[model samples]
Structures are given as structure tokens and as C-alpha cells.
Target: MAETSEARASASAPGGDAGGEDDKHDERMLECNICLDTARDAVVSMCGHLFCWPCLHQWLETRPSRQVCPVCKAAISRDKVIPLYGRGNTKQEDPRNKVPPRPAGQRTEPENTSGFPGFGFGEGFHMSFGIGAFPFGVFTSTFNFGDPRPSAAPRGTAQYDEEQFLSKIFLWVAILFVLWLIFA
Candidate 1:
């Protein structure tokens, strides 16, 4: 079945269907036989077979003195190995292969900052009063003059330790004062 179709197609064509010729033409185009990695500068052996340079070097290094070429099996001398830069017409296997590291001047600048404006670490104020939530915005009577509201406190109850709070406030104030003296 296949031969009949090939014969009919060949008879219909002028120069015996040029597909095979195209395949040979394409073969001469660069191709990597080792990793099948195609690229410009693909290494070519003295026997006229091609493979990527790094791939060929790695292969030879591992099995030195192995005269048989991997692709053609033609006898190859160890020194006949040649480097290829960018010859032949095969596309690189991985188009996005790693590029050489750029110099400092060519490197992209790092980002300076991230996130929303007018915000700093540990400095945020949010008040939400919706259904299924606490129904209150901050209302402090102690900070301003107001009638003393009735409060719940059992007898002999003690408030939070004042010493620790005072100490922390004093420490921060002292640090800030020192900084202000220097900067002002």
C-alpha cells in the first residue's frame, strides 16, 4: 500500500519528489547528536558528523580512547575533535537555555519598596462594626475629660502591673530623646 502511493507520487513529481533531498539538506544544518541539542557552533568531528561541542567533549572525556563516533560509528581520533561555534541549520533544543551571567552594570536594579502607601511595620489602625462583629469603635474616656463611667471590678482586684508598662515607656522615650538630641 505504501509503495504504491510512493510510486504514484514520485511519478507525478518532476524530479522524483525532493523530500529526501530536503532531509539531507536539513541534516547539514546544525544538529546536536549527543543530547540531540541543536545549536549554532555545534561541534563537528573530522569524519563529518556533528554534535554540540560541550556534549561531544563530555562524551569523549567519559569514554576516552573509544574511537567509534556515536553518530556515524566512523573511526575518530581523540585529537581530531573540533569545536563548532554556530554552523549548520538546526534549531537549539531548548530556546530558553540559561544565558551567560551579565556584568553588574547590565544586571537589573532591585526593587526599592513594596506594599501600600502611608504604612509602616506594626503601625496600623482598623475599626470594624458590622453584623457578627463587635459593635464598637474605640471610645476612651480616660484620655479626655469625661464622667467616670461605671466599671466592673471585683473587690481586692488588681489592675495590670504598672511597673513594667512604665519601664517600657521610659526606655522608648529615653532612646527617642537621645536620637532627637543627635539629629536635631
Candidate 2:
């Protein structure tokens, strides 16, 4: 009966106390020992001493097979580091909540299109539109029949004039036409 009355009195108090909240906030701000920079990605050792991920990674890089924590001085042999990503830092989505469908313009490649089993495009007549090289070491010739000149010759090969070739073909065609007219 006495405990119930005390709880009711505390609940009825206005605005609660301010000093208690401030001390909790101050305890959350952790500082790294190495480099003395504010930790973005945190890693905590078994001794409960915290250090920034980058700072600890660099320290481990040059050391021998056995690695030790700078704060607790404990031996760390296996490649295991405890992450300090608290629940307050991460926003988790509930599994029961349904995500809305994205607009057409916002749609990207399918997430299931990874390199797992039954993942890639199958071998068939229908091929995906992509940039590919010709098989059997093939090279394409850039020849324009309308211009009456073959643009296949490389720039460094020889002197290439489109007008000269077109005129030559025209002269031969004219002679053939005259011959055909006379024979008819």
C-alpha cells in the first residue's frame, strides 16, 4: 500500500528531474585512446575498453600474429573484434511492416540477380542488350556503299580520296551503258 502511494506521487511530479538525464548522455560519448580522434566505428575489447575501428585496425596492421589491446593489455589472437554499434545508433525496420512499392523511374536491377545458383542469363536465342566484342578475333570494316568508297583503309595506310573512287565507278558505268545501248 505504501509503495503504491509513493509510485503515484512520483508519477504526478511535473517535468521529472533534469540532472539524471544529463549524466546518461555524458556516459554515451566515448573517446578513442589512439590518435585521440572521435570514434565513428567503435570496437570494444573483452576488457570493456572501447577504441575506434580505424585506430585499432592500423595498430593491428603492423603487428605480428599476436595482437593485444592497448587499454586492457589482453592478448587477441583470433581475427575477432566486438562491434560497439548500440541499438540507439541503429534504426531497425520491423519485419511485419510492409514497404511501399517504388516508382518505375526509381526501380533498379533485381536483388535476386546475384551470382548465386540460378542467377545469370541462360543460354538461348534471346540475348541481353550489352556491349560485346566479335568472337573468332573478328574486325568490322567501315565501308559506305552509297559514297562509292570503302572507308576501311586506316589513316596511316595510304592516301585515301573518296571523290577519285566515285568518279572511276561512274566512268565505268557510263561506258557500260553506251555499249549496252549500241548492242541493243
Candidate 3:
């Protein structure tokens, strides 16, 4: 279970998905709206949203006076929320497997801001409420962003040379394929 959580965290990290931007949509669909991580104990809101049960429950609990869907502000409640069960579970599984994991507690942000302005981390106004998720994810991947990736190797390095060579080889293969199509 710890291994699965660790894998999910790393997959959600900057430069994690090796397949590039195409995988973004796939990943985004399964992520919890509040936690902004892969959905564990996943549930779908009636308004058509994906969220982790704990995150959704915490959000709903925090705003009891206004029990609406976190993603779409539609009507929602503890009873209204449906739990998702994975087909991976087998009838012959271990005893520990029968019990569900405990819910994750919500983190309340401090009043004082540090990294970016206008983003009220204090008011539970996360950047991933839908719009800012792309830019935030992209900027944070590199360019002085929080989770900075390591710098590329210098020009004379063998690693750099190998990468360039591989790119050229792929380019030639692509060109040959295109030419074959044109001539055929």
C-alpha cells in the first residue's frame, strides 16, 4: 500500500510521465480535485467529477453549511456520495486487504504568502480548481519552479552527445518513413 502511494506521488510529480503532454488528460481524469493527486478510494460526484473519498469528505465537512460538489458546486452529501470499488480485489485476499485505509486529513494553509501572489492558499483556493492547473504544473516542472528538474548536461558530455545522436537517428527514421509513403 505504501509502495502504491509512493508510486502515485512520483507519477504526479514534475517530469514524471515519460510519455509527455499526451498523458496529461489521462492522468488528470483520475486525480482528486482537492488533493490534486491520483484518486485513492476514488469516487465520482454526480456533477461528473473524480476525487479521492477522503479529500471530498474533508472538503464537504469543512463547508458543512454549504454542502455542494467541490468541483461543480452541485448538491452533494455523505449519503449522496458513492464509493468506488476496484476490481483488483480477489475473494481470497489477505485479512488486511478487507479493511479500507483511513481518510487523509486536510491541510490548512498559513495566512502569509511566499511563492506566488493572488493565490490564496489560506482560503482553500487551490490553483488546481480547474484553470491554473496547466500553467502551475508546467512552470513548476522547470524554470525556477518549485519541483525543479536537474539541468541538462554540458555540450562536451558523452550523455549530451548520445542524446543528440539518438534524436538524429529518430529524425532519419521518421524522414525515411515519410519518403516511403510519398513514393509509394
Candidate 4:
């Protein structure tokens, strides 16, 4: 009776031969579906299929439009899959070194704003209307009310010089046209 009981105890112990078989089965479960080898940088799909990150990345790139699990044919995406980090895993090789790294977990946070939140369309509204031919329409006056015009560019800059040169040219043209109207 004692011999039989000791035999039963030894067989069921975690350090026994049965435990080695269980470890092998667990390792097999972690094998990649694509390569049929032990998974490195393992990720599990939503459909519960295991794969190495490199294997899945290539599979995804092969058919970018139709991403599905190699095993179950269920819908899978990089973002939808979850990375598996075993207790024994050490940080040796970085996942980012691979062509396409494992997808990062999604995170969302509430927005924070410094000023008034709503749209500012109501406060500063303005409109202008003009009716003239194409070439002579340059003489038309532009009107503004609530909408503030942008400040002129700083002095000595290229934009400032260009604006000054154009303003003088337009002034001379306007004076010549007014004189022609009076003398004609």
C-alpha cells in the first residue's frame, strides 16, 4: 500500500515526468502558426492564433487589403492583436528592430484646452462685394468691419520691401488715371 501511494505522489508532483510533458505542450502552444516554429516576439490574435511578430508582419504585408488569421480565417489586424510577455522573457532583442514592430496598446485620454472650447465663427464675421471688369478691377476699394486685417511684415524683410515697391507702383498708377479722367 505504501509503495503504491509513493508512486502516485511522485507521478503527480510538479517536478515529475508528467510536468515535463506539460511544459512541452505549453511550448507547442506558443509556436507560430505561420512558421510552425517556437514564437519569438509572440503576439496572439483576437481569434486566439499565435504568431511571431515578423511572421505576422510579413503575412499582413502579403495581403494588406485582406488581413485574416492564418489558422482560423478570422478578422485580425496589427492593432487588434495583443503581445504576449512570458514570465521568463528577458529584454534581449528589441521588437522595433524587426521590419514592422508589434503594435502598441491603444490609449485614450480626455482633452484639455487652454481657452474657450466652442467654435469662434460667430465673433468675427465680415463680407465684401465687388463688381468690375478683369484688368481694371484692380482699382476697386476693399472694405472691412469686424474682421481684423493681418499686420504688415516687419521692415527690412523681403516681403516688406516687395509690399512697399508694389504699393508705390499702384499709387502712381491711380494718380495717373485720376489725372487722365480730369484732362480727357
Best by TM-score: 4
The residue pairs in collision within model 1 are 29-89, 30-88, 30-89, 40-86, 41-84, 41-85, 41-86, 41-87
Those runs of model 4 whose alpha carbons end farther than 4 Å from true positions after fitting are 1-20, 92-97, 101-184
- The CA lDDT of each predicted structure is 0.51, 0.51, 0.61, 0.68
- Candidate 2 lDDT score at position 106: 50
Point out the higher-scoring one by lDDT: 2 or 4.
Answer: 4
Range of the 10 consecutive residues with the lowest summed lDDT in candidate 1: 135-144
TM-score of 2: 0.32
Q: Candidates 3 and 4: which is better by TM-score?
A: 4
RMSD of each: 19.9, 20.9, 33.9, 13.9
lDDT of 4 by residue, 110-134 (tens): 7875565435422222223446774
What ranking of all candidate models by lDDT puts the best one first? Answer: 4, 3, 2, 1
Clash count, predicted structure 1: 8
RMSD of 3: 33.9
> Model 3 has how many clashing residue pairs?
0
Best by lDDT: 4
Let me know the TM-score candidate 3 reaches against the reference structure: 0.38
Candidate 3's error at 54, in angstroms?
A: 0.7
lDDT for residue 34 in candidate 4, whole number 0-100: 88
